[model samples]
Target: MTPRPTKKSPDRGDARIRLLEAARDIIRAKGFAATSVDDLCKAAEVTKGAFFHHFKSKEDLGVAAAEFWAETTSSLFVNAPYHQPADPLDRVLAYIAFRKAIIQGDLAEFTCLAGTMIQEVHASSDPIREACGRAILGHADTLVADIEAARQAHDIEGDWTAESLARHTQTVLQGAFILAKAGNDPEIARESLDHLDRYVRQLFKLTEENKC
Candidate 1:
């Protein structure tokens, strides 16, 4: 058999991760338009050459950062410990609790990086807009699956289908983040989610009779 190629050093991966994390922190603090390649390089502690070696352009880095953030944030749902409970409503409630904790936590990072970037770059950059769309779509799809499972588990009654509800939920959450960022209050975000919680509770009440 041919000899195995040498293992790629982890340094590159580490550098990339550092760059993405730095980008997230910087973008969260400053909008995409205000953030520059130099800022990212300084924040990441990597040289401009190193940054360019991994990313073709600042726009490219923005796209990659969106994907990186999506993948990282999606893990919160995918790897959540709560998978089972008699009431499917409980799983959904657990998800809401997790979301609340994320918003109210110390970092107090309000809106999504992709959302912020999209708002800043949508007028000028097709790539960034597309990246933000994909990030949002991925999140909506994940929510759809969970909502469907919860609906089936509890037999909830609503006029909307899983996908519709999923989109609605995503809209509410995104708007909540915007409000939170604009108002500089995580409590506002939590308040926005409260409406959703009420809706879910109503559905749960109706479905109780259908429980096996």
Candidate 2:
């Protein structure tokens, strides 16, 4: 009987994914400006030839990593309980609750990769900055749509617009994540959300009056 030819494993594809994951970690720990192709290779335990084979340059890898972060994390927000709430305001509150849970539970120590990179690289690397900008704006749009839905659902009266609320929510959350990382305390994020929750209450009351 003739021996069947052996099939090669798909190690190259796996290596590319490994390099991506390692790049995320390294960039998260050391801002994009500080991270280098050599650092990524060492983190992934791969060679320069392999890294270059998968990515054209360090900037190329940064762009890919930013896209990955957006796709993955934005899905989390889009799929969370925010959209399924009983009403619009409740839905927005639910989104905050979702973030609070992330802080207290499984996602405790991990700061937001997109937010971190945006703060560090938005003024510098155009590709990464653009990617980060898209991620932030996409997430904000989702939140804004949710807020608009709630405004219609509960018939709330308010002077504020959904766009404003969404932008405010995103900024507060991003700032909280930074403070949490710096202080090494997840509660800091939750505490920031508490203030946001209070602001929501005031807005809700104003909306009830149609003063907005």
Candidate 3:
């Protein structure tokens, strides 16, 4: 979640913000099915009344949390250094490098909340699942312009479109997070991204030094 503007209360304004923050962290750690309204209330230090005041139900809050995840992470990537490169291929590689660089903290800290939530609730709740799908695909869509530009610049031909390749990055990332969590090692995630970086370079016929 974005930084809270103030430490105000539910009645004073910020109950909704607190609840979304609590849901993002706790849901990533515990899975959406396992995280209850009470758990969120306790984590946010808000009461049941406050939670319901902000959200009609836990499912409602789940959807809101996914939207919140998209908003905050979108801001993070928009201002990221990867976008500074003049070469589209360089920008793509830098994106992969940036993903690798940020895998330095706890699983919940760096892993995606939308990815985690969707895996748990996709089968049961359409609303939450759709929210997660939007968050994941929306972020993936941001990469399409760079990927397509690189393809065009190199006159590259492939069976894949920029849209599919962009989504593939998220696929690799989500899988990498799962493997890292299962093995309790962040290196596993980094290794997966290394392979993703190589794949992108190979697709564009670019050498390591070509990255700007």
Top-lDDT structure, candidate number: 3
**TM of each candidate vs. truth:** 0.83, 0.83, 0.93
Instruction: Give the C-alpha miss distance for residue 65 in model 1, angstroms.
Output: 0.3
Which structure among the candidates has the greatest TM-score? 3
Clashing pairs in 1: none
Candidate with the larger TM-score of 2 and 3? 3
Question: Where does candidate 1 have its weakest 10-residue lDDT segment?
Answer: 1-10
Q: What is the C-alpha lDDT profile of model 3 across 132-207, one tens digit per residue?
A: 9999999999999999998998899989999999999999999999999999999999999999988888888777
Q: Which stretches of candidate 3 lie over 4 Å from their true place?
A: 1-11, 208-212
Clashes of each: 0, 6, 0
**In model 1, where do residues sit more than 4 Å from their true spots?**
1-13, 105-110, 204-212
Question: Distance from true position, residue 69, model 1, in Å?
Answer: 0.7
For model 2, the superposed segments whose C-alpha errors exceed 4 Å read 1-10, 104-108, 157-159, 206-212
RMSD of candidate 3 to true structure, Å: 2.1
Lowest lDDT sum, 10 consecutive residues, model 3, at 1-10
Q: Residue-wise lDDT of candidate 2 within 72-168, one digit each (tens)?
A: 6766666676677566677788787776777753233356667777788777789988987787777788878778877787677667889889889
Q: Mind sharing the TM-score for model 2?
A: 0.83
RMSD of every candidate to native, in Å, equals 7.0, 7.9, 2.1
